[model samples]
Target: MYTEDLKVRFYETDALGHVNNTVIPAWFETGRLPVFELFTEQGNLYEVSLIVANLNVDFLRPVYFGEMVTLKTYIARIGKSSFDIGSEVWQSGQLCAKGTTILVNYDHKNGHSVPISEAIKAKLLQQTHPDHPLAS
Candidate 1:
């Protein structure tokens, strides 16, 4: 798993002084970056990157500005050409939200989905996470 930390921005808050629901998805992406980074020795490969096939999010608690948010990312499942990555946002060690991002490998030249390489598959499967979703 990979983790990324972010500070809640003032503008991200709603009238209730809590983070807006829409902002959580962007935060999830921030956390997903490092996981992808592990696959490429040179990060430049991300420019010709995979695309999201699906996204699932669950908001558990309210987040306020000035809170330190940590986003934990890991691969939950790996398929032929797609991978399911899970993430959760935390505020000072308290749970705030959780989600999954499904990315399908794509050929930049062909503009279509393709199978993930064996190197990437082996690397992702080697990672392990505790079974409990809430704990992760």
Candidate 2:
């Protein structure tokens, strides 16, 4: 699992004084950096070849600017050519949001999805939490 600390920026808030809806996805994307890093060799994390098959977010509560937040990211499941990344956003000890981002491994050169490698699977397994909904 990966834990990233972030502050709800002033610009990220809406008129309601809570974080804007758009900010959640951006934070989730930031929380995914570590996972992406593992897929690429050192010093080349930006060169990714995966596609986002789907993304869903459930905002459990409002997050205001200046609040300290923690976004915990973990592997939810591994499939033949895709995997799910689950994340929970916590603010002041409350579960503020939960979501999943589905990504498919792709061979950009060939322009098609590719099966996940065992080595990569094992790496992902390590990043999964025991309480994951899809965990055995």
Candidate 3:
């Protein structure tokens, strides 16, 4: 339920003057920082790193440059060693695109997936959304 507002720059548009499809994913990634901070134990995004394991996006409508867009992010699920996050981009209150991403608990030093720490699991559980799908 966290939101971040982003401006649609002209350079983000394609030849048709519509925001490029690829840009939505980038927006989602950008939006995740604030949401992650809300439920983080250390109150910092730098304390941990989330690595994407899977991503699925759905484009609902076209967005033009010079528009103010709102990116909404939330935690959908938390697993033993992974988590699922959801995001939606809205232009003037209308959905432009929505997506879900599966992220793994990563050991940056080892460069491999690791189990979610108890502290992280507790924080994520505390922020669970009833209207959203949640998993372990």
In order, candidate lDDTs are 0.81, 0.87, 0.82
Which one wins on TM-score?
2
- Candidate 3 RMSD computed on C-alpha atoms after optimal superposition onto the true structure: 2.5
RMSD of 2: 1.5
Q: Which digits, one per residue and each the tens of the lDDT, describe model 1 over residues 7-123?
A: 899999998889999999998887777666755677875564678889999999998998788888778888888888888999977988999888888877888888888998888
Weakest 10 consecutive residues, lDDT, candidate 3?
32-41
Give me the overall lDDT of model 3: 0.82
* Cand. 1 Cα-lDDT: 0.81
Clashing pairs in 2: none
> Per-residue error at 129 for model 1, in Å?
2.2
Error of 3 at 45 (Å): 5.3
- How much is 103 displaced in model 2, in angstroms? 0.5
CA lDDT, candidate 2, residue 46:
58
lDDT tens string, model 3, 1-136? 6778899999899999899998999999897776567445678777666778999999999988977999888888878788888888999889989999998878889888888778777766655555776755
TM-score of 1: 0.85
Residue 83 Cα positional deviation in candidate 2, in Å, after optimal superposition: 0.3
The most accurate candidate by lDDT is 2
